[model samples]
Target chain A: MDPSQVEIPPLKDLTIENITENVHLINSRCPNPRLKYLMKSLVKHVHDFARETRLSTDEWMAAIQFLTQVGQICTDVRQEFILLSDVIGLSLLVDSIDHPKPASSTEGTVLGPFHTHDAMTESNGGTLSHDPDGEPCLVICTVKDTSGKPIPGAKIDIWETDSKGFYDVQYAGRQEPDGRAVMQSDDEGNFWFNAIVPVPYPIPHDGPIGKLLKLLKRHPYRPSHMHFMFDKPGYDHLITALYLRGDPYETSDAVFGVKESLIVDLKTVTPKQAKEYGVAEGCRLLTYDFVLVSDEEARSLREKEAMTAMEKLGLRMKLLDGLPVPDVD
Target chain B: MDPSQVEIPPLKDLTIENITENVHLINSRCPNPRLKYLMKSLVKHVHDFARETRLSTDEWMAAIQFLTQVGQICTDVRQEFILLSDVIGLSLLVDSIDHPKPASSTEGTVLGPFHTHDAMTESNGGTLSHDPDGEPCLVICTVKDTSGKPIPGAKIDIWETDSKGFYDVQYAGRQEPDGRAVMQSDDEGNFWFNAIVPVPYPIPHDGPIGKLLKLLKRHPYRPSHMHFMFDKPGYDHLITALYLRGDPYETSDAVFGVKESLIVDLKTVTPKQAKEYGVAEGCRLLTYDFVLVSDEEARSLREKEAMTAMEKLGLRMKLLDGLPVPDVD
Candidate 1:
């Protein structure tokens, strides 16, 4: 059929139809070759969603307002909107989709929202948990290859919430990086630290994400967990967190970061066993091991680790480096 | 290669191959199909954009901060982020791509950030310029079918700025509804109104978008233009704006609402012709006619119009109606 021969409708009859056609055109214009297909697909889906929903003028305006608020609440230190992604499961989903760990190793989990780039590194056996008030516990882990060979000189980056589930940064002045630490495994790939058994606690509920969850009748609790990242030469880097067995929210963490493989049983050890590790007996002791893949795998793992870390914390790209970044995503 | 024989990388190794792979899996778990796709696509492009730009942590964080401010300045009555969209050309591109008016008709333009839901309707020759303080001018437009037949009872929604480029809403005391009126064309497909010649003006610069322009060393001026929406039963609706023949920023409108076909000369008419139109001699006059396509073609046009409106206004589906709205085009 000739293009001109197609009978064109008048303006009054065209409001709905024009929207459909225009979306297709816009999809064709994206400059990023890699993103063009994805962006076009997204635009198609988004336009379809709008049409299917029969969105109204007032409602559309409201969405604009909501997003604006999301942007507004973000700051140098606060990323309520990123927290919104966590609660909505988008952040975790993105992490999992982007970084599929091998089925054999410990599963990774949400990075939570409190990671700081300025975490101070410590020597082997250094304890991150500075508070002496919480229940005393010892965490022991080994870094090794898939074949069970030890990975000597591995750096074990560790952090965790206090017994009450608060990060050191959450109480900058009052808390001195309590329950948070970075330590290196010994030449034998063994690492140990003392801290309190973290308790399940609610995520910050004073922001828009919290408000949205409240409106949706959802909880904001994350299961008790400890964060660990292992990196060494000739092996894949691993950034993961271990959840405590049997926390109330273990099965339903708000951020969906819990994995059965990452759960460890905290055994109550006697003083004799604690003395062998230079700690008192009757303290909680948890043992786990992280197995790394080859060096190529480690590089890929690092990218995945970084992306997850950034997404979970709602840390914008600007915080990664002081430069202007586009808001495409 | 046999699928089973393919060597599967260890969980740690997999992390190094592609960060997006991890994100893809999590996206699969999203309950909402739309959100699933959105999250997956967003992460992919965001990561890709970052990698392409070699984005650093600080730059990414700054982008987040910028977005946060965009949200902060937004309110029930004001949307600075939408203004951000307008300045970025994304809104116009989205709208034009979504709603491609037939090449023969007057191309649609940006709806702008100042549109209100309620513009008072008036009869033929009704005055919309409530304030008489600005320069005296007359606007005459004919609404016709493809064959040049007049379309009676056609609605013409008209709005523009005063000589100082101020809309009625900009000044609470000077005028109730300055330079804004909605009227229906007469039986002969003709409509006329008395108003002031609009001048070029700068958008509000106290918000985040303003800050962005300052950082980029760009200006925020929009050329003089008039808004129009023509609708009649059994025909398509035409939403557009016409630019003055030679406004300073006509070639580079901040919102990108200008189009060649929509630019018109505002002729200074003789006293006799002015008297015939009930205006004084030496008054500026703008005469133009809007030609609309049939219903089918107009549907495509309206979709584009809506998309453009959505983009220019920083509109989101959440604001629309709690239902998914397609924004692809």
Candidate 2:
């Protein structure tokens, strides 16, 4: 291309058809290959989304303000942006893409805003919930490899909402965390904890994401479930949940975190059986097993997916060259 | 659609193919038509962008964090999100879509972040610049309707950078505004002001937008221009600029706000001519005319465009229904 012959296409009088193409070409000289690709793709999609909706100036301004409010509301303890991501299903999608299951391992779920570190290590069968107005329940689980070998001393970080459906952080007065504990599997690869049965709860509705949910007439309920993070040396850390089988929102969880393999049944135990476990009469008991994948396998799977993704991106880039500009008149 | 025969499709264990569909169905109960359409379309495009990019979990989180920073950086006087919008061309696109131009009228441009109300009214041919080191220039303009009729009493709000290419905002110590004034047209529809010829300058490069431009290997210089807002009783308010011809960045404005029709030539004045404006010998002069469209015509054009946009969106919705879930495998 001769410098004297260079055609300076007027970018000022833009029409709908050429806007995306011009945006795509604007930052073609970005230094980092990945960042450039991401930025270009972002410009294309965001611009197309607006054009596809014929988004008015008023609507665009409203979105900008909403995002500002969401950002302003975030603090160290609260992340409205993450909540926005989760509610929009982006969180779960990213999780699935990064962690492809090998058919035998525990499925991934969304790490909701309620998750907090509880370093208090509890002995097997110890209580986690301290709320008086809670129904007693026993959680029993074994950590094992995909081949069914016992993985003793695996640390299990667990949390759940109280029976009334509120996390410890949501309470006004409590300082110490409740309904949360960290326990390790015994020599037999068994871990058990006494706690109140978790119940479905509405996410915080005072913020921008909640307002958007309200506008969508969408319920913000996450199904009754116990949050669990299982980790041990030389193994992949698994973030998952044990959702109650019959919970009303089991299939309609607002964050789309439910998986068929993660849903477990609860059985009612007699008072005599409960006494042996040092729990109250008619306590519910849930028993399940978690299968961990090896860290090597997880890494390999991620690499495979990344390669496939690059190939797909390559294909999309070709189509970007002959982009169709729809007639605006 | 009998209740007894209602089938419950499993929402659990969703693959990439079905996730977007599930999100589309998640809020089927939204009562507002436009909100529903916007939300559904947003889900489709956002999801598609992620899939097309094969976005990693880390990349998605980084985007969320970047957006949060953009939001947090905004204050009453600063808006980083709007800056982001301008740099990405969304702001200009929205402005163009909302304010379509008639064939005989002046074009619109982005209302940049430097815009502020200049309540200090000045008579024709008064000085607007106060910097002692500034070069002298004369600005003369006439406000007229599309039919070439002079529009008396039309208010022209003008602002420009100093000779060194800094707005009053770029100065840290000044409280009183400089380089801006509101002047009314005379009975013959003429407005003139004495000021320095504006120089090209980089936008605030200390923010996230600046960092992004650096990473993209892009320059942040806006072409030298005078910001003008013309308003009258029954006419559409026109926000435009008189960009200097042959300016280095005229064709490559950082914000893509330059239009060929808005670019005007500057003529160097003789010392005798400069004496008439009480300016230096090497001062410049620019003469231009702005044609405004009636409010009613602007409204009719917007309505026609709205109908066309709806038809386009309707067609896109049909394509979304048969959305080709590409073979990601």
Candidate 3:
């Protein structure tokens, strides 16, 4: 590259007051408008955060080391960074912002770190977990649009911990997948399955994130919950969870995943209801209806949100010339 | 622990607008005042950044993955996190804010990852490197206070790239150290040594930060320079580097380490000067002085900066409530 053609700001000797301007000027050369905007905002916030903290060298170095540890402890099945983000409330914030919905549609929550693509595929009324220790549960759920029309063949994936508050994947040398599986709704937009009532359990907190929780004097337990994800062609995909009612950790969930609309109650199965569902003598029951929005509606809502944010910033800013124009705060 | 004993807000089912508030409320329980402030500011900036950019789930996940890779790639020999911080300009910002100086005091810069405490100690006029392929240069430098009183017995640590634009530690299977060393000044506040004239080089790319630089269309080169550190009891420690005058990359250092006052010139030594310094024919000469501030003065400046920052925030906020009150952007 020619020295004369270099696009970053001609900032040679950066001082404390000028470093931020230099960074912004250099980023002004980015060709992609969206990326340029993201980078610019990121730098401004980070710089402001440091200055506001008056962060010392020792403290700053400690943060660098902490991030390094969070990265180093990650493995194929475990994600320490995601757990960190969840504990810090970032995952939930992003989820809520990205997946806005109407009052009638089901709300979305965090897709906790236990999700995996290898769950066994099953059909309605089939068993999801076969642990002898867990009490049986019968799930009766349906898929529909905002207007209540049945939408058949919706894919539903569910995963949760066993009665012991431990997912099968967390066990040492685990032989097979348990307490988690995938199934599709029937042609009548109804699906039912046999599983256990999941209890509240602690997140994986033996890593740097765990250390951080201890430092903050906060516990590391998430509320009792059963994870669910729904997907169908021409409809928005929903990643949400159902928190069992009366759980002690419900209100102060470490990840803040619980919602008033998502908290659900379970009932003792009657004899007739048990026979109809082909469940064992002692079983609990859960009934729910998931409402989804059309693809066009979801896209329109996203655009509306972006426009609102832009108006809040009071910018009629045109991004077509390539470099983003968001001023440093 | 009893459910009623939890100190965080009794917030359940958080919404987009409420999530930030919930985070701040929960963090209000921290016992350490300083940590509470830092975490509060950090979350605000991060959340504000996400909202301002309308960050999508896909982009957020991509960032998580990028940070994970950065951590995974690190080992005893590499520090990718520090490199990341340096390139994004946070390291320099923190350094400058933490170490503000008057006009007469020397400025500090990024302490790049090449620094290690193992450099061999040498005396004045001794050789720092034994590379047979590079031209030799003699350094004549002194340490003093802002009042121009020479400070004797000051410690100086110097490190630089060889003529090949590589530090001694950059090689594979290398035996002895080269191009870096540590020593002290004599009673007269002067120290001199022989070493190669370092050239410009690129930072460690080929990782996430490198990929980011490429995406931003930014180069990875820093200008030719030698690193210097001065230390003494009751005086502020200085970590800085000296840029060679007229280097092509001078104006666009990748790490943003170059400053006009920190850049210096080198020229051919006169025969008498060469004889006095006991240097071989054709060796170049570099002469400079480093000024430091006392610990008391440094503390006062830091307090002033923090007060100014507080004023900018319009906060006469008291931190004794065991909670920090920095507002979310």
Candidate 4:
């Protein structure tokens, strides 16, 4: 079909069909095929959403103002857009799609905004907390291949909130990292650390996202969980969090990061049992195993999934010289 | 069904169905019924868009960064978020939906970023341009209601870029408004002004929006047009523009503001005819009529359309005390 032969609809008669067609025509000039496809889909959905909701001019202006405020309040220390995504569940949906792990491998969750490099490296079985007023807890976990074989020299990075549910970064006067540590697994792929039991806490809501939560009448609490990142040579990195079972927000984590496999039971120990771990009596212990996938397998799976997605969108590349260029760089 | 009896899907098994369900549950507590309904629909469309596009994590991060940059660049002098909305065809969509005029009424277009509140008040036939390099042009128009009765004393506010495609605001060293004036219609609803013809120019592309245009391989040009706003006490205000026919970007306006009825002929006048309009010999002339709508009729139509929309969205209010509260505030 000739482009010039197309009948352009008048703006006054601006139906949904006209908006979609006009958007597609303007975006056709996009040199990047992937970007073009995304733009078309974004326009279609945005226009349809407006039509479906019969959004008034006031509502649209309100949205413009809300988005602007979200952007204005964002800084190096805070990301309101990411928080918005988290609350709407878009971040988790993207994560799940990007990291479609095999059944045997550990599942990934949101990479919360609190992560920082330069966590102090601790020896095996060292305590990670310095708070004297908090209840002591011990975590014993193993890192291994999908087949359950021990993987030596694996790096286990761990971080969690204190008993009062505040990450060290959340404190305005903090100068040093607390409740965060990195340790290498023993020869048997085992590592243990002592820390305070994390309590449920609301995400910071003093900004626009918080105001939005208030308007939406939604609570802002995330389930208590310990963040972890496990890595080794020739294996895909695992960025995940382990949630404590029976936490008040476990079923409705504000960030939507809770998974059945990631939720673990916290076993309470008596005074004698606590001494064995060199902590006070009645401390809690958590044990779990993380299964990692090989790098080669992970890459292959991602490529396959991407190809299937492109095909579904009718965006398969045109063949040149009996081969097709990948839509993704 | 009881709320507690609802099954909560694990985040790891977060299908599209699960995300939709979670969003509805989280937003259930919104006090405002209309806002609650709108939130549910917004969440549904946003999630569907992400899923349909099979959006990658990198793409999501890129979007967040883009929005942040647009916001950070905004100031008292510039509005980057509004520019983004314009480029995506959203600003036009909102305007078209909000201002559904009668068949006999004039159409409305974009109120671009260059509008200023301080246009000088000029006599009905006074010249508006101070630029010596521009070709003098004559504009004779009339304002009336849909019943075809002249609206005496109606204020017609007009502004446009000079022939060089620069609004007075676009110049950094200017202290006075040029090529803009406010003229009231005579007893016969007739008004005329002397100004320079507008020229097509690119929308400002020196910011993130500019970078986006380059990435998309799309030009940033708007069709040459004259802006006008008509206001009267008992009629709905009309904000609109008249595009010159044969401009290169008329069919592909960057801001999506062009309409069939808005495109007008720019007749080049002979030396003898120019003497009649009291302009230079080779100046151009444009004549058009704008029909306004009664405020009462416009409000009635808006209320009816809004009700139909709410009914379509299944958002009707439950009756209490033999009366139902309207969905709109």
Q: Quote the chain B TM-score of every prediction.
A: 0.79, 0.84, 0.93, 0.84
Encode model 1's per-residue lDDT on A1-329: one tens digit a residue.
11122222211112333543443343333344323433334444444444444443344455566677677666544677667656554454444543346666656555556766656677654666766777877887888876788878887778877766677766646434456666778888888877688788778777676765554445677778888877677765566888888776665566667767888899986778677777776888888888777666644554555555546545443222222223346
TM-score to native of every candidate shown: 0.62, 0.84, 0.94, 0.83
Q: Quote the B-chain TM-score, candidate 2.
A: 0.84
Clash pairs, candidate 4, are none
| DockQ of structure 2 | 0.37
Q: Please report, as a residue range, the 10-residue window in candidate 4 chain A with the lowest summed lDDT.
A: A318-327
State which candidate, 2 or 4, has the greater DockQ: 4
Instruction: Give the residue spans of candidate 3 off by over 4 A.
Output: A1-5, A317-329, B1-5, B174-176, B317-329
Let me know the TM-score candidate 2 reaches against the reference structure.
Answer: 0.84
Model 4: CA > 4 A from native:
A1-15, A117-136, A152-157, A162-164, A168-187, A231-234, A268-284, A296-329, B1-14, B116-138, B152-157, B162-194, B231-234, B267-284, B299-329
Better of 1 and 4 by lDDT: 4
- The lDDT-based order of candidates, best leading, equals 3, 2, 4, 1
* Tens digits of lDDT, candidate 3, B119-156: 88999988887888877899899888889888888889
Total backbone collisions, model 3? 1
For model 1, residues B271-316, the per-residue Cα lDDT tens digits are: 8878788888899898898887666776644555555555654655
Candidate 1 predicts chain B with a TM-score of 0.79
User: In terms of docking quality, how is candidate 1 classified?
Assistant: incorrect
DockQ values of all predictions: 0.11, 0.37, 0.58, 0.38
